[model samples]
Target: GAGVSQSPSNKVTEKGKDVELRCDPISGHTALYWYRQSLGQGLEFLIYFQGNSAPDKSGLPSDRFSAERTGGSVSTLTIQRTQQEDSAVYLCASSFEGLNYEQYFGPGTRLTVT
Candidate 1:
């Protein structure tokens, strides 16, 4: 793809449900990132995967959140036991080799936990 792409542009789930969001980065991009944005708040970094290095999961808000990248291209974020606070827009971005890290972002999946 010419740019990053994400699945299920919108998702609505009940509290305590588990949700999985998917992302496909631009071909050859070596870095992938997951973030979340709540209303009137800044983007919260969730996870990062670059090349073969260990994924930087320092940004995950809680143990209920997890993500992985396969083949250094596709990524998925899973949120377990979702809470109302989990309602937010989940974003994915990609860059090549972190050169100033000008990332290309996908249309985020808006999650509504009710």
Candidate 2:
């Protein structure tokens, strides 16, 4: 199966705008995750979905950030009312299981909010 893939590799938007980032995880993988990385900073876990269970979204930085996984495969991360501090690379990853397993990451979507 193919590795995780993200669309709109780069995005530039004005502050207060909205953006949607998509991710297609490897076929059959049951766990998907979203993360954000600001310049010179470590990856920040955003959200995660595993199997048919409820998604873990406690990592989301604010109420404006949300995500969903459809049919347990493809996922989307939405940032509402984007802020300049939100500028960073949004990364998607997946594994056969949850964080306990080896995870594979996609080429992150770089977002710039000015």
Instruction: List, residue by residue over 22-107, the lDDT tens digit for candidate 1.
Output: 99999988988888999999998887888645446788999999887777778889999999999999999989886597999999
Alpha carbon deviation, residue 60, candidate 1 (Å) = 0.1
Q: Against the correct fold, how does model 1 do in TM-score?
A: 0.94
TM-score of 2: 0.94
lDDT for 66 in candidate 2 is 83
Error of 2 at 99 (Å): 4.2
**lDDT for model 1, on a 0 to 1 scale?**
0.89
Q: Worst ten-residue run, lDDT, model 1?
A: 48-57
Per-residue CA lDDT of model 2 for 68-108, tens digit only, reads 87888888899999999999999998889855688899999
lDDT value for model 2: 0.90
Residue pairs in steric clash, candidate 1?
none
